[model samples]
Target: AQTVTQSQPEMSVQEAETVTLSCTYDTSENNYYLFWYKQPPSRQMILVIRQEAYKQQNATENRFSVNFQKAAKSFSLKISDSQLGDTAMYFCAFTGRGSTLGRLYFGRGTQLTVWP
Candidate 1:
């Protein structure tokens, strides 16, 4: 079975700074997709970033980026210039291509609080 792990359960940051959320996964599937999704206070899950198993370049979106270590199956998210709106519960997810009906496996999540 595949599972995602987020060691840090809670995190905080000051406005206009930076923060990184750590994530790791255990999977035997050779090909898979990893993702970072943010759920704000409203409970809407928004994709922060994603990386294909074969992609070498770390996926980046605006102030968000990921450190993907394929061999170790580690994926961490870095948020630069953090803002109040960036506060949310971040989840690390995985979807293995080996499944006939692809399913999403999510980590427990890390709650981020951005303060002024």
Candidate 2:
């Protein structure tokens, strides 16, 4: 079994500013996928970004980026130019490659508030 942890239960950032959410995981599997997901008030889980365990370079998507450290099993999300739309429940998730395929583990999540 794998476990993901979000140290911060909540965080706040001003509009147009930047904020980072921390995450760490424990997994014995070498091949896997790490992801950051956002769930807004609507309760839709949106994929913010993802990182393959084999990739050394971090993954980025527009204003969202990840700082993935494979050795430390850390995957942090940095949201730039934060907007009111960015306020949501952010989750750190993991999925394995082989036998555990299709199974995803998630952290409790961090509530991010973007203030105007």
Candidate 3:
């Protein structure tokens, strides 16, 4: 059983600043995938970033990046140059390969508010 945990329940940041949301997981499998999904007030789950366990380097996408520590089972997300539109509920998710294609285990959630 793989479980993701986001210690921060809520985080706020000023526009154009940077913020990092912490996430940790417990997984016995050596190979798996981690993801960060954002759901705005509209409540649509959007993929923010993803990191494969085998990849040593972190993954970055525009204003979003991830600090993936496979050994520690931690995958935190960093949002740089934040904007008001970034306000949303961020969820950390994990999925094991093989038989778990449609299955995704998510953390409680982290509500991020970007203030102008």
What's the number of clashes in each of the models? 0, 0, 0
Listed in order, each prediction's TM-score against the native is 0.97, 0.97, 0.95
Whole-structure CA lDDT of model 2: 0.96
What's the C-alpha lDDT at position 14 in model 1? 99
Worst 10 residues of 2 by lDDT: 97-106
For residue 12, give model 2's deviation from the true position in Å: 0.4
The segments of candidate 2 whose C-alpha lies over 4 angstroms from its true place after superposition are none
State the lDDT at 34 in candidate 3: 94
For model 1, residues 1-116, the per-residue Cα lDDT tens digits are 88899999999999999999999999888888999999999999999899998889999999999999998889999999999999999999999888613899999999999999
Residue-level lDDT of model 3, residues 80-104, one tens digit each, is 9999999999999999875555689
Q: Is candidate 1 or candidate 3 better by lDDT?
A: 1
Candidate 3 error regions (>4 Å): 98-101
Report lDDT (CA) for all predictions: 0.94, 0.96, 0.93
Residue lDDT tens for model 2, 1-116:
78899999999999999999999999999999999999999999999999999999999999999999999999999999999999999999999987668998999999999999
Clashes of 3: 0
The lowest-lDDT stretch of 10 consecutive residues in candidate 1 is: 95-104
Best by lDDT: 2
- lDDT, candidate 3, equals 0.93
